[model samples]
Target: MKIRNIFKGILIGVPIGVTLIDSLGYVARVDGISMQPALNPDQDQTDYVLLNKWAVKSYQVQRGDIIALISPKDPSLNIIKRIVGVQGDIIETIGYKNHIVRIPEGHCWVEGDHTGHSMDSNNFGPVSLGLITAKATCIVWPPSRWQFLSSSLPESRLPLNLSPPTLLYSA
Candidate 1:
C-alpha cells in the first residue's frame, strides 16, 4: 500500500514541477565566453541565472535585454544574446555580410557583449520573435556575483536609426 502511494505522489509531483518550469521560469547555467564580462567571466566557473519565461510571453523585448533563444541555424540549440535592434531599427554590422541592416517586422537583432567572440545576429541576421524563450532576469548562483541583469546597451552599440519621438500638441 505504501509503495503504491509513493508512486502516485511521484506522478502528481512531476507534472506539476514540469508545468511550473515550462510556464514560469527556470535556472540555467551560463556556458560560454561569448558574453564575456557580463556572463561567464571566468573560464573555469559558470554562473547560474534565472530565466523568466513569463516576462517575455507576449514577445515584448527591449534593447539591451539579455534573452535566450533557439539558434536560427540549429533548432535544437539555445543561444543567449543581448538585443541590439528591434523591429524597424537600423544597425551597423560588425563582420556580417552586409555593413548595415534594418530589422524586419517581428524580428530583432542580437549580439554578445564580447563582440567578435559571439555567434549571434551578426552570423544569422535578425532572429524572429518566436525564437525567444526567456529573459535572463538575474544571476542566481555564485554568491559573490548575485545581481540583476540591467537593460542598458553600450553607447557605441546603440542602433544607428531609432524611431523619432512623437510630439504631442494640446489645446
Candidate 2:
C-alpha cells in the first residue's frame, strides 16, 4: 500500500512540474560565453535565465529577440541566439556560404553575441520557425545581474531591408 501510494504521488507531481516548466518558464544555467556580458558575465559564476515558453507559442518572434532553438545541423542540440533577420528580410551573412541571403518564409537568421565562438544561423543559415522553443525574457538569478533581456540588434548586424513583407487577405 505504501509503495503504491508513493508511485501515485510521483506520477502526479512529475507531470505538474513538467507542465509548469513547459507552459510557463524555467531557469537554466548559462553554459557558454556565447552570450558574453549579457549572460555569463563573470568567469566563475554562471547566470540563470528565465526562458519564457508562452511568448513563442505563436512563433511571432521579432528581430533582436533572444531565442532558444533546436540546431538545424543537429536536431537534438539546443542553442540560444539573437534574431538578426526575420522572414522576407535580406540579410548579409558573415561566415556563411552566401554573402547575402534573403530570409525565407517562416524562417529567421540568428547569431550569438560573441560572434566568433558561437555557431548560429551564420554557420547553418536561417532556421525554421518550427525549431524555435522559447524566448529568453530575463536573467532571473544572480541578484546583482538581474535584468530584462532587451530586443536590440547591433547596428552592424541589421538586415539590409528593414521593411515588412506585404500580406494579402482574401475572404
For model 2 the TM-score comes to: 0.86
lDDT value for candidate 2? 0.89
Query: 1-171, model 2: which lDDT tens digit per residue?
Result: 999999999999999999999898888777898888678978888888898989999999999999988889988888888999999999988889999999999999999998888989878998999999999999988998889999998788888786444467867
Query: Over the stretch 72-171, how does candidate 1's per-residue lDDT look in tens digits?
Result: 9999999899999999999989989999999999999999999899999999899999999999999999988999999989977888875444468767
How many residue pairs clash (N, CA or C atoms closer than 3 angstroms) in each of the candidate models, in the order given?
0, 0
Q: Highest TM-score among the candidates is held by which one?
A: 1
Q: What lDDT score belongs to each candidate, Candidate 1 first?
A: 0.93, 0.89
Candidate 1: RMSD to truth: 5.6
Q: Which stretches of model 1 miss by more than 4 angstroms?
A: 163-171
